[model samples]
Target: MNKVIKIENGTKQGVLNFLEHLITTDKISGVLTLRKINEKGICDYGFISDAKELKFADPFAPVMPINAAQTLSSLTPTTKPIAAIIKPCELRGFVERVKRVQGSMKNVLLISYTCGGVLPLNTFQGDGSEKIIADYYNAISKGETPGSIRPTCKACEYFVPMMADITIPLLGNSESESECSLIMNSEFAIQISKEFQCEIITSELDSKIIDKVLAVRISEKEKLYNKTKVTKDGLDELVNIFGKCVGCHGCSRVCPICYCVMCDFESHNFDYNIEIFETELEQKGALRLPPDTVFFQIGRLAHMSFSCVGCGQCEDVCPANIPVATIFKKVGEATAGLFDYIPGKDLEEAIPVMIFKEEEFEEIGK
Candidate 1:
């Protein structure tokens, strides 16, 4: 049974207050949420144990410094239970990581929301930051898609979380500005909510508005897929797109799914060997220094395409302005679709690559 709890203060404040309540009442040991670090309007995930410290917490901050799942993966399965308010994509990323043994949810209460998408880091750091945030919140209040969101966010259809223990429905509801509603999804969440000081609402969420946002996101995704479609025709288009890579590999660094401790791409194995260099020079007449730019991207795509959560962090950090997120999103969708899979949609569902059956894909051998 889903239980809804209504908070009297504004939505953002309500979340802060609730986190404080949870801490002060000993419901949880700490909270992991976005908190303002300085006056410059920068925010990042903060683990707060003191209820008074939640004053800096803003669970709805419109910027993502890093995919919080990576941080959660590093800190989780703690000695004590804690609550984390993460974006839908971040939660999904954590779920994917958990499946890979990169993280654990044993003592974590995952709270996610109907996401509004985040602004590109450049937009947030540039001038008019306040107006951008104000406009974003205004759009959010009306349950409409905010302008100037990241490309992946515009194309994201999975804005609503599937596996979170609790959900904050922010899409399409006008009352989101004046109050906050917590929808307890799991039995644990319901039991924990028994101590929360809020009114229980029995009404169902309005799906009409959510559907409108989803339709726009789907349309945007189709447009992006058309623009960034990698062809089986040749590597010429692939070379042209990734040719500008300076080999910084920022995309892989920020990718939550690329959980390797020492990436093969960065190892001595990829270093220039005199023999291979001479051979490549003889075969192709010339070589791109710091080789395998396209190979690295494709290699990662092959490795984690089925698990990419479309958080836009990779594209956000790309120095070359490569549409890394869009490409990954398109490829991930197609690859995951082949197995009738949705990454992070279910905890019990095994990843396609992690499981094999002899009866499956009979036509592949032929």
Candidate 2:
């Protein structure tokens, strides 16, 4: 049974009020949201272990707290479950990683809010001091949607949080400048509704409007796919996309799904002997200092193409501003498409790249 609860203004303040009501009555362990401090401060995104810590879920706060999903597996499972507030993309990314890292989800509840989009760290024109999401929100509240989003986010058409236990809508017939509709998608969600004192309404959602929003998203995604599709047919075009890589390797370090107990990336595995180093540069008139740049990315693609959630954290941490996420997302899309799979779409289905079976590839079985 689907139950809908309406809120006023959909402000951070109101969201917290409803959440606090649940917490006080022992409905959930905690609820996740933003905590604003005067329009400038690092927004902390973590589990609110206690209801008193509701200050972090501030409405006017600017910060993207996507790390909470990564935190869930680290904490012990609780009888008192938690309600997480996340945007569409972050929720999908974490759900995908939890399975790989063997993270715990014993008592965590999912709550996803609508996404307006975001500005990356570099191009984001702000105070430029300690780069935060609050500044970006301030811009967005004024109806200035960031001209550019992380390439992965821009291409994503699943703007709604499909994996969430509870779904909130900010688009179409449920539209309200100050309201976002909330609904429970499961039996547990129904039990939680007992915590609320208001009547749950049955509202009509327009299927036609849903199609329009999705159609626009698909058109935008195809444009991005064409724009980023560069072939290895020549070096010039490839160089234009990945030329300035300084071998910092920031992307893999921040990715949640790139888990390896013994990464060859570290522990001097790639370190060359004195004779080997001299011979490589000696053979070529000029060898790029990071000689295996293209190879390294391809290696990661081989390891992670199916699991790649395209969180854009690689682009976030890049110092040389290399288009790393764009390249990975493009490659991942093709690799995943060949198998007709979308990474993180199904929690029960194991990643095709990670598992092999004797009966697999049925087309060639005969």
Of the candidates shown, which would achieve the greatest lDDT relative to the real structure? Answer: 1
Backbone clash tally (model 2)? 8
What lDDT would each prediction earn against the true structure?
A: 0.86, 0.63
The candidate that achieves the highest TM-score relative to the unseen native structure: 1
lDDT tens readout by residue for model 1, 1-366:
467888997778887888788888898999888998777778878888999888888888888889999999888878888999999999989999999999898889899999889999989867668889889878877767787899899899999988888888877667876888888888878876678878997655568878888898999888878878665536898888888888998898899898999999889978778999999999999899678999999989999999999999999999988888988998899999989899889888899988988798888878
Model 1, C-alpha of 192: deviation from truth (Å):
1.9
- Model 2 earns a TM-score of 0.83
Question: Model 2, which residues run further than 4 Å from truth?
Answer: 8-11, 59-68, 76-79, 122-125, 128-148, 172-177, 203-206, 232-236, 357-366
Q: Looking at model 1, which ten-residue stretch has the lowest summed lDDT?
A: 225-234
TM-score for predicted model 1 compared with the true structure: 0.96
